[model samples]
Target: MRRFLASALFLSSALPVLAAESKGGFPPFNASTFAGQLFWLALTFGTLYLLMSRVALPRVGAILADREAKIESSLAQASKAQAAAEVEAQGLEQALAKAKANAQAIAQEARSKSAREIDAKRSAVEKELAAKMIAAEASINETKTKAMANVEDIARDAVSAIIEQLSGKAPTAAAVTKAINAARGE
Candidate 1:
């Protein structure tokens, strides 16, 4: 596109020179004059072509080649960068997956540990409660035995006192024993 624009600009600038000198100041077309104009146009075109091909075109071609090389190099660099970015992204994904796995494993371990701890605590509490209940039962039985012994003594004393009050004398041992046994409903 740049080449086409440049060529158009060159042709437009050169038009006045080509139109200014026709033969006889302002003559119509003839074979000889046409031939002359044709010859000069051809000569100019050939010389310009040679100059362009030998010097101008070669320099321009070198510059265009350099630009193309630079552009291709830049594209290659960008492609490498993109590839590196993709690799880094993949690495990050893998790391994240590993981290997630580790976290899950840790959570599972924690859950298992907590369950074991809870079970242990429950068992310990149950054992303690059982021991306390056993102790309480033993204590209750001891208290009941002591209370029964005290009641028997009190009954004997009360019977002896009642006999003394009624007879105005102490009862004999054998009689007291007999009386106590009868009152006991034995």
Candidate 2:
């Protein structure tokens, strides 16, 4: 049925072209049949206008509207995706910041702990050194005291020996001690 209608419309549109050709001249330029040509032109134009307005134009308009709706939907989805990506990025940034903060805090804690340990070790070493120094000083003082006591005895013996050699007689211990003390300004 649709083919029949299309064929009929094609035949009808071709009738004027056939007739003009038969007349052996352009009918549109011929003033003698102006009225008839104008009538057919108006009829063809009106039919085409009606067909476009009622059928073809409406379908085209529907297709355009569908395409616009699809485009808008795609744009909306893209916008939503972009927003979600931005939100995720922000979350990542926050997580990174938190991680950095935690790392810094851990580093600070480690540093403080190490510092404390170092200080403690240093203090212990200082205490050990001080103790060793004190012991060394004490040992030196004891050695000096023993040497001083021996020096007094040795000096008295030397003085007595010298007096015996010079006079052919030994001096008394009391006299030697007195002489040594007087010479030492004691």
Candidate 3:
């Protein structure tokens, strides 16, 4: 249907030129044919204008509208994707912070546990040293008692020798004992 109308418009525009071809050197420049040429030009221009306005231009406008809508939809989708990525980034940051906090807490717990262990070991060592000191003191006291017993006999022998040296005779054991007891306030 559109092909037939286009052909009819074409034929109508071509008719006068076919009729005037034999007589003219240039029909467009001729004074008598100028009115006919102008009339046909108006007819052809009006027909083309009506066809473009009614049919072709509307199709082109619809295509442009669809292209604009698609561009807007793509922009909206890209924005949504970007927002989702930002949210994920925030979540990852939060997770990293939580992990750091957890790591610090664990390290602190380990330090405290090590300190407690060290304290316990130090206390055990201190207790062992205290016990050793007490044993040493007891042993020293036993040795002092034995040395004191030997001192009495050593004093008796010295007195006998001194008397023997002065009088050319040894002192009797009983006399030495009595003298030593008197000197000692026993």
Q: Best candidate, TM-score-wise?
A: 2
All candidates' TM-scores?
Answer: 0.58, 0.63, 0.62
The residue-level lDDT of candidate 3 at 80 comes to 99
Can you list the residue pairs that collide in candidate 1?
none
Off by over 4 Å in 3: 1-54, 164-177
lDDT scores in order: 0.88, 0.93, 0.93
Taking the tens digit of each residue's C-alpha lDDT, what string does model 3 give over 133-166? 9999999999999889888889999999999999
* lDDT score at residue 93, model 3, on the 0-100 scale: 100
Q: Which ten residues in a row have the lowest lDDT in candidate 1?
A: 22-31
For the record, the alpha-carbon RMSD of candidate 2 to the native fold, in angstroms, is: 10.4
**Deviation (Å) of 121 in candidate 1:** 3.3
Error of 3 at 171 (Å): 5.5
67-97, model 2: which lDDT tens digit per residue?
Answer: 9999999999999999999999999999999
